[model samples]
Target: MASTTVADGIVDRLIDWDVARVFGYAGDGVDPILAALRRKEDRIELVTARHEEMAAFMATGNAKYGGGPGVCLATQGPGAIHLLQGLYDAKLDRRPVVALVGQVVSTALGSGYQQEVDLHTLFKDVCAQYLQVAASPQQLPHVLDNAFRTALATSSPVCVIVPHDVQQAQAPEPGQQEHGIVVSSTAYARPRTIPDVDDLESAADLLCAGRRVAILVGQGAAGAEGPLREIAERLGAGITTSLLGKPLLDESLPYHCGVMGHLGTTASADLMAGCDTLLIVGSNDPWTEYYPAPGQAKAVQVDVAARNIGTKFPVDVALVGDAVSTLNALVPLLPAQAGWRPEVERSVTAWREVAGQRVAQRPSRLNPQLVVHELSEHLPADAQVAVDVGSVTYWYARFLRLPPGVPAHLSSTLASMGSAMPYGIAAKLLHPDRPVVALAGDGAMQMNGLSELITVADRWRGWADPRFVVLVLNNGDLAEVSWEQREMEGDPRFPTSQAVPSFPYAAYADLLGLRGLRVEDPARVGPVWAEALAADRPVVVEAVVDPDVPLLPPRQPEQKVRQTLRALEREAEGGQAHELLRAQRAHEEAR
Candidate 1:
């Protein structure tokens, strides 16, 4: 009999790849793999969640921060089923994540055992690639090899279904495929082409002639911060970011204007509208709603994805190149002139003061606006912040400027709840040298996965440093959605019994051997948040926000959402016009 088992081979491949931890929960379907993973715990740590769903989220968070594929394992049926939501987040966000689901014995797979579903069918569409590993001796490394390759190459989710019988079976003879990983990083499928210097100079000349110029940063400017700031400084242009580009420039920076899009600030939009030229850096937004209003400014768009060029508005210039490369190429062509940047900055300052004055006038108790303002001032520059989906998502998405490249892991599109705790665990694994904190909601935290605190404890050795602190905006109900629903259709009596429900958020913290604090007074929040950040272990703060306070807006959602729906509906009701609605086209909203 061969000394090595099939389980041994599977784990060895993972261990060789420098995967520091694996996130999952134990069930009968994946028991053998769990046992095998444990044997290599010194090299590959095994992290278990209360639910397999959390495992997937944590794994993607790890991949997002670590810049590689993350591994998640789950059992049959509901275990595999629950993992889909987080997996879809990874797929959409373009993070590489792999899910290993354990099926029943190969013979029992289609026979419908207790927790059996055709996982291949259930997961195929959601994943970039799905593979069903065979239960024979010769099918060794080929299965494992394909899983790793597909994940990295596409930067999308992949699946490898391991049957229970196959996992526990004896190992096969040594083969070439077993040690056959190329161990290479995948290149971007679409690299930004270098633009012509003459074209860049022509665009630069147009921008220089304009009296007011503003630069718009989008997610496409992932690594172009330095060049962007340089361009802004050289041209005396105002700088603002898209929702995804919030951290590219610090909010406290003098040149920082407000954000762009439907959630954009009035002041930011107004300032940009006054500009004679708007230089879009690495954005592909087709809708004018995301940019300035129609005829607000003449536009020039740059992108690495060539297809996105001039797809939105009538682009006066389309610079087909990487954002950083283009900016470096364009900087020398411009003549130095102290132009409208100072005026733009002054306007932004005036607007902030006006908004602050308005906020200062409203002395509402349990004001979340107060909490956000104070917290933004206090958080350390390097501390990582993660948020949950709900009221805080709107607040932080609109306001919190932690700095670009910090990985503020949160869900978009799906906007599922309870990703905070799980993503915190993954961030800790990825960023062991830094602290990671989660800002979540009370009602949103009800979806389970509290046990992941223990995983942080395991990594931090139960010390009380602010490695992971979860701040709960506990307003007593699912008030964020409730308020949005009420404002949308007058559905006043939806459900409120569980709205103010209290679970011992602190009690669970103690159970997990982590420190917990509850902030009842708004005055105590500034100090409480500070104390939480200073701790060495995981911490939880259950903050009581006023349920009556505007989560979205008391009466503003209908007009805003209706406008969005109508714009989207119009695009959907037509064809190439659909691109504007599709977010794939550039100019429907502009037109």
Candidate 2:
């Protein structure tokens, strides 16, 4: 029998923790660990990504969608450096991810060896929860155990840097519990948490006192849907979700005001503005201006993390506990009523009409809104969505109506581009039987998504379900930033900065041995989506959408509108875009 090495020990700990896969790109620095993984291939799979950054993203996505601490590995120096973007994504989004990075040999600690880096210092900020360097073979088990535990307990990224020499060293024997040895077991269980009874009562009292209440939820309120609905029904409250929270509740509910923020709907704006009392459930959405003006609404916040309470909005009562536990306890205290329901329903109804009008616009080119809106009709009940950050995010936020329980995730707080491809891949890997749709803008596709497409092609044949669809909004402009410049700075769309070089995304997909469908005409939008969703293999539907379709924020004030119009007037195609903006704003005002 082969004696267990420290690398083998690391893999053993991963198996003990039930980590099914580890995503990474190989390098000489991690050769020992890679060999160990290859030997244990039957127990735990290694997912090779095109880039280390993408691997980290896959890990982060796994954590977000799979509810486990995602594990990623990388070699020393550049490979470790490449993992930062995805690590930061995990950090900002507060997802549990354990990153195993290789370091230089233990003896070369001070010597500037080839591919050597100060891995601890580099990972310190992103993995602030825990960072450990294993110099001795005896320390491997404890360090790996602590990395997993800290990641799971804190719901944030952690790092374990193993020197090359340490990985090749002999592992501690089963009975080796000597004086200098620290043996640690691999196990962690989430504690059932609840706020104090008095705090729950205080929150209940605040909700009861309000005539019109609005419940704003974020990702933290994920499992509390049942109790959340019950409390909303009792308080006669309207429900609105932050972009991250959009998938937590059923949008089909009459009083559900889609999403709240710049990318949100008019009904959500009204829900935030009209409410006298607010119940913020596990939401730390940063759009403070969109929230009810500081003193307008009395608020109660429930969050698992105490640090998040009163950080975004002023709170009358803070219930630091699991959302489900807190909301369940507060439900009985709320008075049953239906007075605020009708008004909320009316707002939802009006917003639907506005959304319909916006998507129905028959522009000369394909309207981007129509590109995503058409998917709502054919979206599968079991599908998972991965959305990139850009104008595509706006369309997804406003138009796509996700079926109840269909999870859609994006780089929300970090607002990172090129996240959709890796995120979608991770989601699909977790549930091979379920289909996945990734939405991306031209700029985002070019950033890192195009390269990750090769990964999709490489793995699709192995998946139980082959219906992985990538929707690329192929407008030759960085539309989101262009609009932001006009809206925020009153600057005209700068062609040099905004223009994205044209690329035939559909053609590239076809070359990669996947089904490719191109849609430039407004007429083919629905049919193409239908074809892609039903394809036998992975498909890329490249929609040549109009770049000028304004990313107009909900309830835009007169001054901002004027600024946007002034910026538009200086552009070549301003007339058409100006008309589209006017029409969209008219829909909101008329609502």
Candidate 3:
């Protein structure tokens, strides 16, 4: 009988789960596991990332794009610690991920040995389930199985920590099985949570009673677009989406009012304010101030998690179920009403006119809005977009129109920077037939780590019909932070917000052997994007945009206006005085 090592057992279990890939860095603490991974290279491929954080981001992206539990591995201490940011991104986004951490030898633990730390306590908050110091070889299979199972079942991250010595121990012979040891045989599946008939009837009654109804959606309503559309058409409702739910429906639909919140559209904000009844589906949007005021409207909420049903606002009827099932059951109970459709259509038309003018406005440098809008026009109908957080997010949220069936991923909940590139790579890896683009800002690209672009370049040769593209809005500063400081604190631009050096990102892409294009003229933005999209390999397009363009909110708060006025007065004697005065005038005139 052949005896296998605990590390081998763990790898075998991963194979059983059909997880053929892992992203991580190899280090001394994880040598045994690395060796096992090498032996199984034909069956499972290891993607070595430039940083552990990038590995975690890649894993999270994999889970999101592929619809399975993403796997990442890292060594003890610093390596494990580096995975937190990406792990938190996965946790907050509610994606399934499994992180395998290597620990110090069992004997060396608590003896101040090198690379030893209490990983369980470190990961307690981020992980839905955590396991540390697997005592014996027999426990390896169970630990691996449980990690994958918990991650998939809860749609959250799970961590399994293995000691170096424990992983090297020999497993029991094939016939000598331990009693009471049961390895999980559960497959990765998410059963729909349907609401009870009473709950559905109650929600339908509340919705039917209102004169004007509006539907608000989030990422959890991903596959229920048809049902949602049917219900909205029946009730003559306007549809507004949270930032994460922007791609859930066709943006070109007449009743679609676009995103709602700070980065939302004027039409969406207006529709939500005027509605008599609001039906929220699968969104826990935290911006309470943007929602309809309490007692102003009757609210109905549908969510898989019972705790989230009424947490965002007071609900008249709470239907606790999956978005598709609940929407399907409630559509028949409502009567057809044509009262609200015309009002919503008019608002949407007016908002689109204003947006069209903004997109056509020519600045001294390229307009970020035009770049995103033009990209949207040229994008394939089924393209997938991953947007990084920053001013770039404003352009994407406001201008990029995704048709139904086109998926989009963003770091909305955690609102992290530098996630676009990793997400693009993962999306491309999983769906090689579709076009994937990462929209990022210059500062965010540098902060989150752009070296991962090389990972995409390295793997591009193996991909079928690879169409990965990275579009960078290189404005040479942290534009979003600068605008926030001026709007919130009445402060003039400082060194920290205005001192990012412009790097040759397109040239860097060329050095990595990926197709690269740089556009400084506004006229060239569309042409360059077209060329990048047509490239056979991974490509990057860097467009120089104006840093002076302010990202104004949909509706500027009074306090924000006052702060801007104070900031303009303070900068009266500075070099930007004339520019600031012009912006202030334009802002006032727009309102």
Q: Return the top candidate by TM-score.
A: 2
| lDDT tens digits, residue span 1-591, model 1 | 242767776787676556678788899998988888878787887888778888899888887666468999999889999899889988766667878888888877677678889888889887856555556644655666667777775667888888888888887765334454332222324444679877897798788887778888876676788878777887788877766566567666677776665445544665566777888887654335545557767777888756677666667888888787888888778777786877877766765664353234232246555566667766766677777887777667555657545667677545778878888777766666677778788866776545666666556763334467787777677756654554445434245443546788866787788888877676787898888887766788777665544433211234654443343333222232222223311111221
Q: List ranges where model 1 is wrong by over 4 Å.
A: 1-3, 129-140, 170-212, 262-264, 271-288, 294-322, 333-339, 358-364, 398-406, 449-451, 454-466, 486-500, 551-591
Q: For model 2, how does the per-residue alpha-carbon lDDT over 248-367 read when each residue is reduced to its tens digit?
A: 998989999999999999999999999999999989999999999979999999999999999988999999999988888888888897748999999999999999999998776799
Report per-prediction Cα RMSD to one decimal. Answer: 7.9, 1.1, 2.2
Arrange candidates by TM-score, descending: 2, 3, 1
Clashes of 3: 0
Q: How far is candidate 1 from the true structure (C-alpha RMSD, Å)?
A: 7.9
Error of 3 at 510 (Å): 1.5
Lowest lDDT 10-residue stretch of candidate 2: 169-178
Ranking by lDDT: 2, 3, 1
The C-alpha lDDT values of all candidates are 0.69, 0.92, 0.83
Best of the two (2, 3) by TM-score: 2
Worst 10 residues of 1 by lDDT: 582-591
Give the alpha carbon lDDT tens digit for every residue of 171-279 in model 3: 7554444576655554666787888898888888889888889899998887889999998999999999999899889889999999998887878888878999999
